[model samples]
Target: MNNKTTISSFFWQIIKPYKWWYLVMIPGPFVTAAFVFGYNYAIKLLLDVLTQDKILHYGDFVYPVGIFLGSHFMVDIFFRISNYAEWKSQPQVRKDIMCKVYDYVMGHSYNFFQNNLSGSIISKIKSINDGYYYLFESIKHNLTAKFLISLLCAICLLCINSKIFIMVGLFTVGLVIVSMTLYRKLGVMQGEISNDYHGVIGLIADNITNIANVSLFASKKAESQSIINHQENISTPLRNKWFKLNFITEIIVTMIYSLFGISVLLYSIYLKNSGQITIGDIAFTMSMTFLFQDNIFGLFIEVKKFVNTWSDFKTSFSIMQIPQEKIDKTDATELKVSGGEVIFENINFGYENNNKVFTNLNLKIKAGQKIGIVGSSGAGKSTLVALLLKHFKADNGNMIIDNQSIYDVTSDSLRSQISLIPQDIVLFHRSVGENIGYAKKEANQAEIENAAKMASIHDFIETLPEKYNTLVGERGVKLSGGQRQRIAIARAILKNAPILILDEATSALDSETEQQIQKSISDMLETNKATVIAIAHRLSTIKHLDRIVVMENGAIAEDGMFDELLAKENSKFKALWDRQVNGMVL
Candidate 1:
């Protein structure tokens, strides 16, 4: 992005209505400067009056001392109040920015989520929050303070001698130009280094999640070496950038200080020799010159920080600009799902590769019927369900529910009427009750218990020390494979959608548990009046299903009743059944 656009967008994104704190902070510099100027003037007066005529002048000393002390006290008070306001505004701004970012990410389509890592998204949001807070604090507190001090120094310098004032101002401006030129170069390096760091985080998260597989393959040492390599890659560039900026800033500041100090000393000597100014005037001028130099130094540091923050602000704003899926219009009609009839007419789609997974594939599922789908890996079973949920738009198709095109209805309304349990069951680190309640958030304890009973898991839950309150640990790792599958089933049961889909749902359970769970499910379907779609690998699991459809290479391989298919030799269904039966030693 160009500098102007990046800066404008960054400010618009991070600065919100609460930025009134910045306006409140504007006058702090003037107030502080006024007090400092008053104190300095009093010092000049005290020095001139006390030394002149060697007189007692008790009143003169007393009045000037009070003015100086009182002005110093007021400066301190203004500093404290301004600092308080600046810090107070930080947390609110952080919260507002984080909330907006959260909304943006959550609103994105599932495809966006598939392309990004959860840990990276979380890290980006956190990094942006900290960056914004620092940026605001630096501008509202430190920026204003330094700018005010610089102005005070400029006024003091002019009051002392206009020649020295203009010269110092010119030199300071030169130093700033040089520093900023160098800062811009380092800013690019910093941005690159930050991107590399994010890559490291993504890598570590991926590795840690797959640590079991890594250990199984004996690649632990190789993984550690890879991480070390990435760490060094990120650190080396950052160190080089920082060291270069540090070295350059130090040189410029030193040069400016040296030149200014020499000029002040020589000017004071020349004026004193020519009898143009008194020793007291020279002394006060020198003190004020040093004071102004200190302020100028502070200003330089603030400028460097401003440059770095500008870079980070640009990066964070760009991330927020990535396109997200558009939500349906506010007035879109709600889709009414009943009897679970699904009709697909002339459907066509592919994942960015343009190789269609389904092309003009028409199918109809009647209400109250159990449809069994069997397919090899990559046969588009999961893809079909994902499209049914409208996770992405079909290249061209009409997916109708209750005879209405799903696209015409609100997405949430369509999804709410269908319960899907995928092959991989992901359980949150929460209580069993809490996890199950995700399907029906308002469900009371009795409703939760009822759902568990329907899924054949209520007995197992009651055996735990805390029953429904038992913590499942991360991804429900504390539970056995069969137990976790049952909990997922309970969640789906609680949803109680008119249409239910179980994608390889029984793949993890033993035969006894599977049979019992299936029996419970059949009974519950009858009791609740729900339709079911089961995707299975064992083939035998669907012998009781109403209709079985076999898929091969993204197309239907065969479709027939279990008994009729068993009577035909070399048929896809019979071959699958024979393989499964022979594999079971019993």
Candidate 2:
């Protein structure tokens, strides 16, 4: 949704929908500045009246006192209005940003997830939340109100006495120029720090995910040292560079504020001695100088914070700049599975760096066909499944389902018709029932139990303390490899999609369990009249299928019925069958 090229543009566009809330907030800063300046003006009048009694009207007492107190009341009233507006606007803006970021990030192709760390991506998302919070607050309070207050005081001094104005104005400009220049350099440094922090998080996440491996190898010390080395050699040095530059900026800023204050006081004494200005004017001038300095200090603090926030905001949210890898046609329609026939026509595809997996390949599966695909490593077996599922688009070809081009339909609709039970199944940390019910979001308990029964996992689940309600733990670590495989099978049966893909699905199960599950799956698909694609390294898994296709070197080397292919002399299927049979005997 973020077609905007610049971050500022994106920020403003997000805020634009709530423009009315912003309008109510904008006036608060201006009103606050006027009250502060008017309060100082009133104080001057009160001093003048008190010092020279009867020279000005004695009745001026009430007017000066009233103006001074009235300004305070205005300040209080305007603050409430601003606070209410902020309450309405801030959270909504953040909510919209988070939702937009999630939807857009999820649209990234399957490879995006495979290539990046889960923790690093999570950290960047959090950065957007904090960065925008700081940036927005700084703009409202410091950049707008405090800024107006500084300018008003400067002009007030110029109107009454030119000398004080020149001294304060020069110092203000010098500090601003120095700050802006330093911030540009500091912002880049902060971006580097952010990168280091993300890397550390990703490293920790990677280690945690491989905890089993580390414990098995007894390499905890090595892993700990690796993390320490990364933090000391990289993270610490970048942060230290930021701290040093911050100290230098602070030193320069202190010098300017100190010099400006000293000059103002010295000039005020000169004016009083020459009888050029009254005691009342001295009080007003000193008061204005102090107020102006405070506002400048406020401005400096905000700018420093803004620099750091900008660094985080841009670096983290830059993922928006990446165009989605897959998109549907503008007129894309929902996919309809009429008999579920799939045709791959003149398909050419490759992964990164022109690593060709398939070239001008073609295949066809009739409606409700039980097809078995067997191949060795890098023989385009899995790639074929990935392409058919539309996880990656073909380089030059059309994939049609039920006479409709997959490219011409929405991905969600296309994928809805297919159920995939991947080899390495990763389950959410939820109840056993919830994991199985994932296939159908609204599935009842009865349906889930039935699916589990079909997959032969229901009996095992019943022995657990909470039965189907038992927690799976992180990535289903609570369960054995065989148990996890059974859970995956249960989901596919529950989904009962028009098309089913089983990629080494029963590999973890024992010989008897695998055979039983395979029989159950064949019966289920045959009952539903669904098209099934089974890819397996185990030849026994596909021996019962109607037809077997043997793939080699990215092409179909042989295709026939199980026994028909074995009967052929020097057939590809016959050689594979003999090798597996011989290996089993050994």
Candidate 3:
């Protein structure tokens, strides 16, 4: 997460912090393999003592018994020592990885979140953490210990008989070649499955998020069938590729083991007939063969797990490759808000694949001035606010605040000077006080209470069981539209920035409450000489504003005071005002 690492190198980059612990862990596997050899030798010694033609001595029994108990005790001690470091490091590393990945996701542009599913992003982050768990386990139980066991067992066999060791070595090579080839294919298949898995998570999230709509439309069965279809699509490939390949690999491994067992037994018996090795040597070889074979089986299972983990990790890591949409210029400076005079010069903008919404559009609002913008839907009202907030850069134009081009200033600094009350206000699932205080983190209770009073929501809030401490629920679902809008207003009022923009700020309130809020907003603005740009669909909400600008399509059609615009026959504002007065549908 800290370094610029490729997917393949990220594991080691994270592991580097705990290098000393891993170094200490290396000897644990060696001791485990050594224990296997020691225990096999004990078995051989015990068999030799029991089968001896001459009377067995008590000393021989003592030697075998001591070897068995000592090997077990030694391995247990070595395991506990190595495992302590491993347990200390792996879980912490996973927690760090999840936190870093989540932080990286947070830094992504707004468009990225809109384009991707939240659930899918969460799933990917989980995969990265789980993959690390698999990697550490594989290193411990699969690769190091198993390889050492195989090597040590081969050496033991070599000491017993060169011919048997040669056969075991060749079998090891063949089995590895076969496993590697199949594992490579499995890796590719697993990558495909990982993608499908992410998609399913996203689809399920989408369905659940819109559960209200599904219930309203009474499409329960339809939605269930949709999920079933997706499951079927995923399961077919999973069964065909994932399950089938694993079964084939298992079958091949089983066949190889059977053949090796038969060959070793026949060779050992022929050697016994020729008096080349004792019964104890044969016992040692057979016992070692079973031990080594079990480890190989475990190794293959872990290797498959590792391959799937690597595939998931690669899929999840690809997210970091997406370039962040908004990046501050290296030479950008902070925005110093001496006065909040805003100017839009020769602006050109349009949504992708849509006709131009603004061409050479221009507007200017002086400091300490309050102006209302009135327009029908698709009249570039919200787009103007978006450009002001730097949500989307215009195709061509310069937006200047206090004579500083917004692009020349750092985005964070630029936005800090302007407070916007958006049309669709989404509140966090938290206490109302926390949501209001979000605009100003250091704001105390007195300041938060004052802002809520100014927004005209304090009285209603007092009626709740928890008052300001009441949970808002997800996206403020527990609140009415009017309540949510007032919450947004409170947040903006608390911000108290030099520049303020309100888009449909009072649309959800009733006419009486709207007028009260209009007065409250005016009183609040009068104390602070800040610039205000208000966009309104309900024209009366902004009728008391100092000036009105009427928009048609992508350009301004009329500009004047509210009464002045109404007096003119050709004015767009007058037409809109007339329509509203007549209670006409807009």
Q: Candidate 2, which segments miss by more than 4 Å at Cα?
A: 2-4, 53-60, 463-467, 510-513
Cα lDDT tens digits for candidate 3, 116-136: 998788888888787777777
Q: Give the least accurate 10-residue stretch of model 2, judged by summed lDDT.
A: 1-10
Residues 287-399 of candidate 1 have per-residue lDDT tens digits of 77777777677777777777676666566555677867764555778988777888878888888978778878777788877888887778877777888888988888788
Q: Report RMSD (Å) for each prediction in the order shown.
A: 3.0, 2.4, 2.8
Whole-model Cα lDDT per candidate? Answer: 0.77, 0.86, 0.84
Model 2 agreement with the true structure over 486-568: per-residue lDDT tens digits: 88888988998999888877766678767776776776666677888899888888877878989898888888888999899
Candidate 1 residue spans exceeding 4 A from truth: 1-16, 19-21, 76-89, 327-331, 510-513
In what order do the candidates fall by lDDT, top score first?
2, 3, 1
Each model's TM-score, in the order given?
0.91, 0.94, 0.91
In model 3, which runs have C-alpha deviations exceeding 4 angstroms? 1-5, 49-70, 234-240, 508-523
Candidate 3 pairs with clashing backbones: none
Error of 1 at 112 (Å): 1.1
Between candidates 1 and 3, which one is better according to lDDT? 3
